[model samples]
Target: MSHEQLKRTALNNAHRQLGARMIDFGGWDMPVTYAGTIDEHMAVRTGAGLFDVSHMGEIEVRGAQALALVQHITTNDASKLQIGQAQYAGLTTPQGTFVDDLLVHKLSDEHYFLCVNASNTDKDFQWIVDNTKEFDAEVENTSGKYTQIALQGPRALEILQPFTNVDLGAIKYYWFANGTIDGVPAIIARTGYTGEDGFELYIDPNASEQIWNGLLEAGKPVGIQPCGLAARNTLRLEAKMALYGNDIDDTTTVYEADLAWIVKLNKGDFIGRDALARQKEQGLTRKLVGFEMIERGIGRDHYPILIAGQQVSQVSSGSPAPYLKKNIGLAYLPMSHVAIGSQFQIDVRGKLTAAQVVATPFYKRSA
Candidate 1:
């Protein structure tokens, strides 16, 4: 679909005015980059960057049974989440396949918010509502009620502190608070997808443009650039973060995706608990692993993985690391060959190039 036909965020006009290269991202007309992907990526890694992530889904579960409803649908132990804290989790199908990964924020005893993938917004909302029918909770699809902006990197706090009266210092990582930005009531969460010390600001759609511009103006002196989806993808990939539809999908299991930590099989009877438990005991047949190309070639999505020169699996997400200056990617291979230091081959444009499995988070910033 054309960009004009796609859904627009509050900052859509600003992005276009800034000469951003816009692209159709899951029916949303979003910027891919303003200056360049690598430049924006470096800006976020070294300094700061702002991302207009208003396309993501915001859902609310409220009632006496909110906690129980959420815990039953998600793979993580939502019951362990205290008020104001957030936990990364996956909503899995009955067969233990991931429907979508999300961040569950415990707003209160009877209220919880789930930030879900942009593309899976409707599906996730429907899933939650359908599943919660038996519970006393009420589900609301709040996707259109708010716009989200991620101010990421080391300087993010400095840029944001000036606008809000909230004690920025008191807001710990993975926690949130009701606050105001430029006189606009909002929710500020010390969370991000880029693996950086950052915050995601949930603002009223009416106040989104003002906040976006205010952040850019305030951050310009500190070298904070308005990043786009291109940089966001690379940044998350470098951090070994999973992306829906690419790294994980409805057909992919959380265990095979190396996200077993989020699957709380013992957290009572969750939707996928039994299947996940079986998989855990039986062992995963295939697993996702990070690989770096040893030869001179860039491995990309769907690239064939070879074991003993025979095709074994394929890459799910691949890109040249702008930060590491190396070609890196994620691929699913037989569990036997997923160990670090295991050698393999990847088909890069019909040529079998040598590659090796390596530990993830290819780049980690110093504290």
Candidate 2:
């Protein structure tokens, strides 16, 4: 898509005012970095960093059969969720590939909220609607109704506590509270893509600037910085969090992606249950694994993997993990190549370099 066709979030002007370097991300004109990616990345690790995640899509499912409809479509057991709880799930096609990996928020027994990938919003919404024909559920594409801000890092709680009367401490991971943020209606969830103690605020688009500004001002004492997409990507990679388009997609099966935990086989019939069950019984051919560069070369997405002079697979997501201070990446290799210490060569820019399977989550915070 051309630059003219790129979508802009409510914080577009704010990012520009901060002199953030912009880039087209999945058809959205977004800030890639400000004050350099490494600096912003380190700030989040030691202090706090704010992110504009408004481009993510939201879908609302309500009505008497909402639970039934959600259970039928997603791979996770949505029935296990209680009000105000959220669970990571995948909307699967019957063939057992991901429609989209999403977070399902159980607002009530008859109401559920889905947070979907920005690029898959329309397709996922239509899929849900079409599948709900057998159930009495009302599915609404409410992506434009809210703006989301993620306050992430070690000092996030200290920074966000002053602006809301809602007891932020009481909200546990994967749980949310419906309250006002700076007197604006919001859903404050102790959830984040980056592996850290953080909260994501879902508020009206009109209140985005206010919340963004307030959080920054309040976080000044703790050295808060405005993070961009570049930092977000690196942070998530360090934590081994999957990026939809890169680490997974419609062609990747949940089992192959090492996301079998999200597929609840005994949760009663789901879209991909039968295929997943068959795959489980027969065993997997290829599986996702994390690897580190042993030689001085940075392997990147789609870079071919060679084992004993034969090309076996390719990289999915790779980079020099900022906090870990090492070059690492994720890839789908043959099951035989997935064991820790297994070695291979990565064809980086036509030059072969050594690599080895390593433990995932390249970075972990101190307890």
Candidate 3:
């Protein structure tokens, strides 16, 4: 798509003002770097990093059968969620493949808020709407109404605490509270993609630029960097958080992706419950696993994976983990070689490079 055809977020100008290098990420013109990926990456680890995630999508489900609609389409047990809590979930297809991975937030007994991937927003909205036909729920694509910003890293709380009246400490992980930041109404959720102690704020779009700037100013004392997507990608890789199109996609089932934890079979029927149950019984042919470059090379996305010189799988998401200071990636490997310490080779530019399976969630924050 042409640059002119790409969508722009509300914080577009704010990013440009800081001399951000913009890139075309899934039809949206987004910042890829500001002070550079390594600098931004390390900032989020040691201090804090503010990210303009306004490109993400938000959908609202309400009315009498809202919970019913949520339970039917998503794999997580929404019935167990309280009004202020959130849970990670998969929007699956009847064939047991991912439509998208999303965050489901319970706003009230009759209302649920969902955050979907940016590129799949329209399709997911349509899917949600189509599924709601069987229930008495009203679905709204409210993606345009909010700006999503993520403040992540160890010092996140210290930097964001002064701006919001939400009592950031009170909101535990995956929980959210309705509050105001700098007098702007917002939903402060203690969630993040970086696997750090941080918050994702869903706020009014009109106040996006203000919030973005104010946070930067407030965070300046602690050396908070305005991070872009490249840093975001590397950070997520280190944490082993699945990226929708890269790590998990329409053709990949939750089991194959090694994300079966999101599937609650006892929660009763969902979009892909039967297929998943069968997959569980039959066992997996191949499943996703983490690997580290054994040789001095970086495996990139879509690079061929060779077992005994025969290509079988492709690297799903690969990068040099900035925090770990090592090259790592995720890929689907046959069950015979899925165990940690199993070896394989990655065809990086026609040269086969050695790699080995490793324990996933390559990095974890201290509790």
Give TM per candidate: 0.98, 0.98, 0.99
What TM-score number comes out for model 1? 0.98
Return the TM-score for candidate 2, rounded to 2 decimals. Answer: 0.98
- Select the stronger candidate by TM-score from 2 and 3: 3
Lowest summed lDDT window (length 10), candidate 1: 1-10
- Badly placed stretches (over 4 Å) of model 1 are none
Q: Is candidate 1 or candidate 2 better by lDDT?
A: 1
Error of 1 at 69 (Å): 0.5
Instruction: Assess the local accuracy of residue 249 in candidate 3 as a C-alpha lDDT between 0 and 100.
Output: 90
Relative to the true structure, candidate 3 reaches a TM of 0.99
Clashing pairs in 1: none
- The numbered model that scores best in TM-score is 3
Over 98-183, each residue of candidate 2 has an lDDT whose tens digit, in order, gives: 89999999999999999999989999999998887989989999999999999999999889888888899999899999998999
Candidate 2 vs candidate 3: the lDDT winner is 3
The Cα error of candidate 1 at residue 90, in Å, is: 0.5
Please give the lDDT score at residue 59 for candidate 2: 99
